[model samples]
Target: MFTCLCLISKNVFKRRNKRTEFEILERYKIVLEEGFENGLIWEFYHLRGDKGQEVCRIYTQLGNVDWHRQNQWPEIYNFFIKNMLQLEENFLMVKEVVKEELRG
Candidate 1:
């Protein structure tokens, strides 16, 4: 059997008040990339919907998704967990700021 890790984390933006997603995404990328020591860099992969417009939340992976069931699952999971924790720590830096922005 094989394993496919999916949906590590995501963000959905409403683009209210005519705010552009491109600007928002770029800002977010910087915010996330800051202190994002994870080796796996999650990008905007359009799995479905219009190629230019996505109506659903953006999905990203924290580790290698495809793996052989008995080959390296443990190692991959451990590494992913480490990165996830790091991501959390980094996010904590700007979590309140982001929340306040969202409330606007």
Candidate 2:
């Protein structure tokens, strides 16, 4: 019984990981389709599947500063832009990871 439980848990873990990877890839595709450089950010907040629920959020950078508020700090805007770039890179990496996992 213990061995069966362990196997079951392992399978569940693997499934969850695969689901997460797929979700990340899907989100990445959506982000790209939405165009990261078009002054619009694609954010995925809630991801649900058979394995469970996961949250994937990606913020795209806007080249214009027209949206900046008068009271907003310069550092905050810089950080936001940096984070957006990181998210875009992360999505690319995650897509490769998912492809490898699927191949294996």
Candidate 3:
């Protein structure tokens, strides 16, 4: 009886884990779609959409002159810029690339 109960509990845990994983993946998909849409907006306008400035502000606020070195600013800025550039490039490439011929 104890062995059976242990096996049942293990199976229940596995089911719950799988369900949680699915939910997390769904959430990630939603976020990626939103990011892509926002990137599209930014690409055309040369502007950072809604959350963009806020994210930069968060980093700025976290970095104090006393604690965070001034030299790190360029590094952080470049990192964010690189990511934005990559996203923009990906969006543009997708828009220009034709995959219909390959499908056939």
Ranking by TM-score: 1, 2, 3
Q: Write the per-residue lDDT of candidate 2 for residues 1-104, one digit (tens) a residue.
A: 00000000123233566455435456446444443344333333444455455444333433434435656456456656665555555556556765676576
Give the candidate order by descending lDDT. Answer: 1, 2, 3
Q: Write the per-residue lDDT of candidate 1 for residues 1-104, one digit (tens) a residue.
A: 22222232223343443234323434565555554444334444334343444332322253444575557778767666765565566567766876666566
lDDT of 2 at 70: 51
What is the lDDT of every predicted structure here? 0.46, 0.44, 0.31
lDDT of 3 by residue, 34-85 (tens): 4443322111111236433211110111123332666766755654565455
Native-referenced Cα lDDT, model 1: 0.46
- How far residue 50's Cα lies from its native spot in candidate 1, in Å, is 15
Candidate 3 TM-score to native: 0.27
As a whole number from 0 to 100, the lDDT of residue 104 in candidate 3 is: 26
**Every model's TM-score:** 0.49, 0.31, 0.27
Q: Score candidate 2 by lDDT.
A: 0.44
Global Cα lDDT for candidate 3: 0.31
Candidates' RMSD to native: 6.1, 14.6, 19.1
